[model samples]
Target: MRPFSKSLAVQIFVGTIQRLPQSARPSGIYKTRVNMPVYLNINGFEGDQQADLRVHGGPDKAVQLYPVAHYAALIKRFPELLGKLAPGAIGENISCPDLNEQEVHIGDLWQLGEALLQITQPRSPCSKIDEKLDCKGVAAYIAQSSKTGWYFRVLEPGMVTAENRLVLVESGNEHYRLCSILSLMQQNESAAIGALQRCLMAPGIADNLRLKIEQKIVHLNRASTGTP
Candidate 1:
């Protein structure tokens, strides 16, 4: 088995929520970065929200949670020592407990121990990061390189405080990691279709993601396979 990475905590600030559009948002969550325990989960996405946890604090943005960075300037100086196989597939010296279920695939969701949360999409780097660092397009660099962060879909609504054990529950298709599958999907439509089909068969995949996959399948089949 591959060695697991370590998990880190970052405190969230409450002021950031003011920037979000109010909808499906629970009032009282903080916006500042706070130290919260992020663990590996079987959902194929890192930093899963627990079923018994209500997002106590996060940006009022659509997905309320803090996104950790995969890139660290500290390791860039020693890329040769890092043995970066694919630049950003996994960060150098990755230290987090985010598990991708048994297999880790796209459109996968997992329940925290018993019932906690549903990790869905990864936190792709955005322009907002550029301002944070005063560097234009830094976020784009991390995203293009595949160091995109992760997020969770709230389930089993409860409070998520610091020191949460963040149990890993297996749900959806635990076969292919989302990043790997996405890479394949972009190249070979046939393989992408197969992967999407596999994801379709997984238990508890979110309908939105599934629909997106299906749409891609339809478009790709027509473009690459010449669907009749």
Candidate 2:
């Protein structure tokens, strides 16, 4: 398939450290941001670090992206979040316009600066976001709103700045959009069997996510046939 006609990078952020909350125990949340002109490799930004490696910062999740457009609406919903939430607040490395869950598909390849990237999967919104916001259910809100941004796997590593434009050089797995996959994963209903199956076969999908889909397919099949 052809690349999306346009994709723009509004800001670039790299994590500095995982910060513990002011009046709470260690949160393991990377709440700091780094300067631009950062190095991006298969592992992730060179200076960045994720407190929990089990759920973040791997080859399949080299880069985290959030749509800049989602910020305004989110701020309106939670006024307290107006100043607290900004680019990189949710652990995203790149903030972009025009790239949302609906339009970006798994396996889509992009050219950014001198590097190549492939859309791997949607970022599974976690409880840490709520902890960061000091408001419960914010993570669920992100999921329900479908504003949860997606992740990118580095195909070729290079330096990237905030102003570097994102060019979609290749499109992958048009059979499933990132939002649809996130919906299916969240709902896990038998109605999404076809989508789940396609996701399992889709190239560049994370192994853990693929396994989850496989399990869901088995569960759905057993339920449909009333098997034990």
* TM-score to true structure, per model: 0.55, 0.89
Per-residue C-alpha lDDT of model 1 across residues 31-126, encoded as one tens digit per residue: 233354333322212332322123221321123232233344313633532442222222111223343222344333333323344445444444
Colliding residue pairs in candidate 2: none
Model 1 residue runs over 4 Å out of place are 1-15, 18-31, 35-69, 73-115, 226-228
Point to the candidate with the largest lDDT.
Answer: 2
lDDT for every model?
0.41, 0.79
Kindly provide the TM-score of model 2 when superposed on the true structure, using C-alpha atoms: 0.89
**How many pairs of residues collide in each model?**
35, 0
Off by over 4 Å in 2: 3-7, 22-35
Q: lDDT of candidate 1? A: 0.41
lDDT of 2 by residue, 90-131 (tens): 878878877788888888888888889988878778887887
Report the Cα lDDT for residue 54, model 1: 32
